[model samples]
Target: MTDQQTVTYGIDGMTCDHCVMSVDEAFRELPGVTDVRVDLVAGGRSTATVTSTGPLDHDAVDAAIDEAGYTLVAR
Candidate 1:
């Protein structure tokens, strides 16, 4: 990616460690994703900063996040 671009997602419904694990695992499976971090505090809002090797499609990212049972807030 260009200078390590970071994409943050406002995730919802992340209630515990399991939520963190699931979200982390799902994002890690993506092709260009390099790292994923999630925060389950504040009524289940996670900021996942995906460091990709190249540009990422927001739709695809959103889909992955949604598939993990979380709603992604547009930043």
Candidate 2:
């Protein structure tokens, strides 16, 4: 077993549970990703905490968020 590493990303345009699920599912599909936790804030930036076996690829994470119809911004 490998130790999990977590990273938080700031996301915009997530205003509901559906949005949270979308983002969660997006990150869940990535290789090495073990878990996803979302802190949703309506009408503003939300935070996504991702746990994986190792450090994740920023570009991949960005693309996944984009595919989920959201934007991942640096915080």
Residue 62, candidate 2: C-alpha displacement in angstroms = 0.3
Runs of candidate 1 exceeding 4 Å displacement: 1-3
TM-score of 1: 0.84
Clashes of each: 1, 0
Clashing pairs in 2: none
- Whole-structure CA lDDT of model 2: 0.94
Question: What is residue 61's positional error in candidate 1, in angstroms?
Answer: 0.7
Residue 57 in model 1: lDDT? 82
Tens digits of per-residue lDDT for model 1 on 1-75? Answer: 155667777888788888889889888888788888777775756677777777788788788888988888876
Q: What does candidate 2's lDDT look like per residue over 1-75, in tens digits?
A: 787898999999999999999999999999999889999999999999999999888999999999999999996
Between which residue pairs do clashes occur in model 1?
A: 1-53
**Against the true structure, whose TM-score is highest?**
2
lDDT of 1 at 3: 58
